[model samples]
Target chain A: MAQPIISFNNVSKRYPGGREALSNINFTVEAGEFVLLTGHSGAGKSTLLKLIPAIERASSGTILVNGQSISTLSGRGIPYLRRNLGLVFQDQKLLFDRSVFDNVILPMLVTGQSHAESTRRVRAALDKVGLLDRERANPVALSGGEQQRLCIARAIVNRPTILIADEPTASLDDEYADAIMEMFRSFNQVGVTVLIATHDRDLIAHSSPRVVHLQRGRVLDKATA
Target chain B: MNALIRHHLHSLRQSGVRFASAPFAALANMVVIGVVLALPLGMYLLVSNVQSLASSIPTEPQISVFLTPGAAKTDVAALENRLRAVEHVRSVRFVSREAALASLKRSPGMADVISTLRENPLPDAYVVTLGEGSAAAAERLESELKGVPGIAHVQVDSAWVRRIDALLSLGRSAVILLSALLSLALVAVTFNTIRLQILTQREEIEVSKLIGATDAYVRRPFFYWGGLLGASGGLCALLLVFLAQVLLNRNLSEFGNLYGVELRLQFLPVADAALFLAFAALLGWVGTYLSVSRHLSKIQPR
Candidate 1:
């Protein structure tokens, strides 16, 4: 009934060297929807995810996030647009020089959230990711799984409406991957939109969630097949 | 309002931590900046003192009325009274030839030089002090003294003072040129330092941008750090200048005594110190702004 939270209409992307990353894609994701974008490496899964946050601009067509066309957003407008979106990376982009707490509170600091409120929210976010006990620990000392979870905590700390993770569980063991999926499941259960890009078939097979499969640069016609 | 204040406070605290983290490196940078600025500052003090000494030359413009060698004593007395009657002349004193030789013999190193002479070779003269010390006024007084009877030659005795004044003006210009060059070098040093810092923090900058940091949010801490570094450098420069003045003034005074000249060396003044610190801080902020602006735009979340 509500407008789609993210809409991509005939979107395409081409790198500077003339390699087409995504070609004439069409998709619409409603609010509170949990979707998995599965594709091989260089099949445009990461490119598609990046387009939502305007990290990578589409070479053609349009993308609308939260019912607003984001194709013409200025440099100053990008940060405001990103305030409502949470991004997680497979590499665990945590600031190793800072403590877990500081990394978790970075988003709040950017948006000028009050110190008292930021502290409380940081504690809650860390607690949710089971990293509250390591709040004072340096991020460099964190295990890979723990580090990925820390990224998730940092991503979600701003309480964004959309959570996007690009290959969030790529290098983790099955146990840790499932635990990460479970964490995403809980966030989605709370009516947050979650789109995860991954190539792991086992994680997709066990979930039975709506999966958008891309081969090369085109999404498969699921209904026709 | 509260959040803004908090962010500023956080940036301040973080800058302090960053500075303290590598104390030795920071100290080295500050010392380099200090040395760069101190040389010009020392030159500036030296030039200012020389300028003041040149302007404060205590030589009143006096006309030396030299009579013909065989002039009568009565002619000398009459010339003194006539010189006193001039409108701009303040006082007149008669120096007899015998009196001049006696005074020269009283000098510490001049007695032997004078005793070698068979007789007093000095001419009887009248020293005419003027009411005003301007070059035009002294020139007019010299002409007035020349027209008096029994006077052969009139000399305005400020010739050497004019030469010293000319040299002091040149020294002032040189000091200005040196200060300008050193200030520019200080800015360049700060620019490189901030550039290196930006390189080391390139990862953090990228991560911060990925998480929705605005340019200002990411730049605040670096700006604070640059200003802190510059201010420290300024303080160190002040200390260096002061120490130099102290160490040099003692020997300078003794040397001055050997030449029968008094040298009073002054340290950098309060206003000048304040301006120097402000300038260093400005250079720091500008350097950081330039470095950050150039590098930050290239580091988007991609």
Candidate 2:
């Protein structure tokens, strides 16, 4: 009925020097849907996730995010496009120079949120990710799991409609990975569209969400739960 | 609008904190800018002071009409009236040969030289002052007075003033050239400083960009940092110039005592100092803009 929150029609990405990261990929995720993008290393998982935020442009075909064509979006329009997205990178990408709270507050700061509102939202996001007590600690002091959780806190602090994370549980223990998956589940239950890229077959097998599998830059299957 | 103001204020504080974090490095860069700016500013003040001193001396350009030895008193009186009637001629004073001889003898060492001369070799003259003080105007009046029947020679007696005027003009030009060159150097210093800052924070910038930071949002702090550096350097240059004035004036007072005149170098005026600071800040802003625009585009997140 309503427009899909994200739609990719024959989307393809070819990096410089002739390496095709994504080839004729097509998918659509409706609002409030939880979809998993699973592939092995160099299987275009990161590239596919990066395309949604306009970090990487499609070499062919079009991608529409929240009803706007990202293929032809201007440079000035990219930031506004990204503001509606909450992205968590595989590397955590947490700024070590600042405290955990500051790292989590960056998205709000970039969108020009008020100081009082930003503080309240930052604390709430940290609390949701179980980092409220460590807000004042430097990100460099965070453990791998805490740092990963910090990235999620930062990503969700802006209350973006679409939450996309790339390999969020890649470097964590099973318990921490399960906890992170639960956190994503809780966010998904509240009407946020969630798209996660991961290679953990067992995690996907145990989960009941729809799965889009990629192999050699092509979507191998779109298996519904 | 409130959010914009808040963002600017936040950027300003961040720049200030960055400067404070590396005081020695920041001070070194600012000192380099100060020294470069001080060279031209100090030269400007010196030239201006010399110009004022030259003006303080009696520099009214005048033309002298000397009569031939056989000219009668009535001829001299008629010539004075003719000179006064000329266009742009303000006034004419008649000096008799005997009065000139008397005034010459009034000098400390000229009486003996006058006594050695034969019966008054000095001729009566008319001192013609013009409304215009230009050298060309004085020469024109001199030629006109020379055409008169009783006048033997007409001399424009403002040569020293013209020489000083030419020298001051040259000084002003030199100051302008030096200021332009040093201003370029100041901008270069700020450019390099901002470039290094951008490089060191490359990761932070990439992260910020990925997190929806606009180019303007990312550039605000660097702009503030550059402006602060420039303003601080300008202040340092002003202080350096003022110290130089004080040191030079202290020595000048002793030197002036020998010449029986009070000579002191003046510091830059408040308005001029304020303008200098503003100019420095503008230069800093320009440098930051260049550095950020050139480097920011190359740092997109992978």
Candidate 3:
């Protein structure tokens, strides 16, 4: 019912060596949709995911996030674009020297949110991930599963309208992977535009969210085949 | 700016936790910067002080005007008064031919030579002291004295003043040159230390950048670290300067005991201490800013 949260128009990325990573790629992931982007390594899944939050600009086209053109946005506006989108990594990439509270508060802190506000929101986000009491624990002390969840909590601490998670559960066990996917599903159920880049379709195969798989950086229709 | 500075300080503190392993490197860099800066500063103060002491010797730069033979005593008196009235001449002393003869005989080296002379060939003269010691003043006084009717020629005694002035200027220039070189070393040492800190924090920076950290958000801690290092280094420099002054004062007092004058060496004052702190902070901030900007900008984890 609502407008598409993200839209790519004629997007193409050519590396410096004259290699085209993505060729006129077009895709739409609307609000409240859980779109999974699956592809082999170097197939441009990361590039496509990176474009959603304006991390990397398109070489030839525009990317609209929440109806705003991302590629045209200035460097300063990239943070605002990112404010509406949460990005998670498989390695968890958390500052291990800091406490869980510090890790979760990072995004809000980057946006220059006040300490009281950041603390309240960080606690709430950690609570959502069921790591409320582990706020004081160091990221290094956490298991692989806990670390990924902590990454999730950090990514969503800003309450972004769209969540672009790249391989969120790639390092986790089956149970932890299911947990992370379930967290994504719950966020999607609450009307977030979730576009996850992952090869772990088994975690969400039964649920049947709209799957947009890619092969060699081009869209493929596995269903009809 | 305060928020930006605070954030940098916090980041520095965060990064500093893991950097505990390399405390010696940081301290060594700070000490090296402090020592390097201190050397030229100390030399500058010493040279300036010594030059001031030498210039305050209180001997006026003077010119001697000898009267020609058979010149009228009245004319020579007039010339002496005229020399005294000249703006450049502080005052003039008149010496009659006989008095000049007696004084020459009393001279340590010339006493025997004067006793051997058949008559007092020494001319009557007027000695002129100028208010300021300079080539122009000396020339002005010399020209005026030469113009007097009874005067022979004016000999300006200005060699010592020129020698001392030249020495002071040369010394000051050397101090400036030395200070410049040391300051470069100071910045380089601080910069390299900060660069290593940046290098060491590459992982932390990459992780922070990957997780939506803005450049400022990421750079806060390092900025503070640099600022603190510089500030503390400034404190170290100040203390070292003060300590050096104290040691010099002791040595000078010992020398005074040898000379029975009880003199002391002066240290940099409170104003200088404040300036040193500011200088230290500026150098540290610049070094850190340079290193952090270069490294943090390149830390793209993807």
lDDT of 2: 0.89
Sort every candidate by lDDT, greatest first. 2, 1, 3
Q: Candidate 2 clashing pairs?
A: none
TM-score of each: 0.87, 0.90, 0.83
**Candidate whose TM-score is highest:** 2
lDDT of 2 at A69: 99
Using lDDT as the measure, the top candidate is: 2
Could you give candidate 2's per-residue lDDT for residues A1-225 as a string of tens digits? 856999999999999899999998888999999999888899999999999888999999999999999999999999889988999999888888889998988888888788999999999999999999999999889889999999999999999999999999997999999999999999999999999999998789877469988999989975441
Q: iRMS value of model 2?
A: 1.3
Query: Can you tell me which runs of candidate 3 are displaced by over 4 Å?
Result: A222-225, B1-22, B54-60, B64-87, B93-127, B133-158, B257-262
Find the candidate with the highest DockQ and give its number.
2
Give the residue spans of candidate 1 off by over 4 A: A222-225, B58-63, B69-154, B256-262
Residue pairs with backbone overlap in model 3: B7-B220, B8-B220, B8-B221, B11-B221, B12-B221
TM-score (chain B) for candidate 3 is 0.72
The parts of candidate 2 lying over 4 Å away from their true place are A222-225, B54-60, B65-82, B85-87, B95-125, B140-155
- lDDT of candidate 2 over B1-302, digit per residue (tens): 48788789889999999999999999998899899999999999999999998887667778878889888768777887777777777778888899999998986668888899879988888887776555577877777666677888988877777789899999999999999999899889999999999999999999998989989999999999999999999999999999989999999999988755788998878998999999999989989998998988899887
Q: Can you list the residue pairs that collide in candidate 1?
A: none
Q: Report the lDDT tens digits of candidate 3 across residue range A97-169.
A: 6799987887766666767888899998998898998999998898888888898898888898888888888
